[model samples]
Target: MPLKYLTADQSRAARGLLNWSRVRLAARSNLGEATISDFENGHRIPSPRKLAAMRQAFERAGVVFTAGGPTLSNRSAGEGGVIGTQ
Candidate 1:
């Protein structure tokens, strides 16, 4: 099945919820910071592979994207340590 990419707003919101910088997400997702910045700024749409990489990175860090918005996983939220990376 094709993966659903996060919208620009959701991508920004997800990063906000995670308190993650583009650099951090880039490292986690193995994507360039410029690509992430462009995507978040609505300058461009990422490819399926790139989108999947970013989404997967967020998922691994306990971010949950919902129809409403992005949220922290219960486990991570309860722990009060949603900061999954440096």
Candidate 2:
């Protein structure tokens, strides 16, 4: 299913699953690190376009976003389980 929306906690969980720093995600998503940090910290929500770019970057790196949270793609599943929100 397509992701209808992404939560700040979910974004942080995805980053933890991927072992990605804000700088790396920002670089991959073509966004600024400050933007990512702000979003993850719940200070601001990104525009749809920027959020799409972040999701695409994580998906390309084998992370899958689900209704429950972020999980590894089947291709990378051996590494770990789902990263769920609190």
- What lDDT would each prediction earn against the true structure? 0.72, 0.75
lDDT of 1: 0.72
The reply for model 1, stretches above 4 Å from the true place, is: 1-3, 70-86
Backbone clash total, candidate 2: 0
What's the CA RMSD for each of the models? 5.6, 3.5
| Tens-digit lDDT string for candidate 1 (1-86) | 23356666666766787788999989999999999999998899899889989888877876765554334556634231132221
lDDT of 2 by residue, 20-85 (tens): 999999999999999999999889989988888887777677665555544554554434335443
- In candidate 2, stretches whose alpha carbon ends up further than 4 angstroms from where it belongs are 1-4, 69-86
State candidate 1's TM-score.
Answer: 0.76
For candidate 2, what is the TM-score? 0.77
**Candidate 2 lDDT for residue 41:** 89
- After the best TM-score superposition of candidate 1, give how far the Cα of residue 21 lies from its true spot, in angstroms: 0.4
Task: Name the top lDDT candidate.
Answer: 2
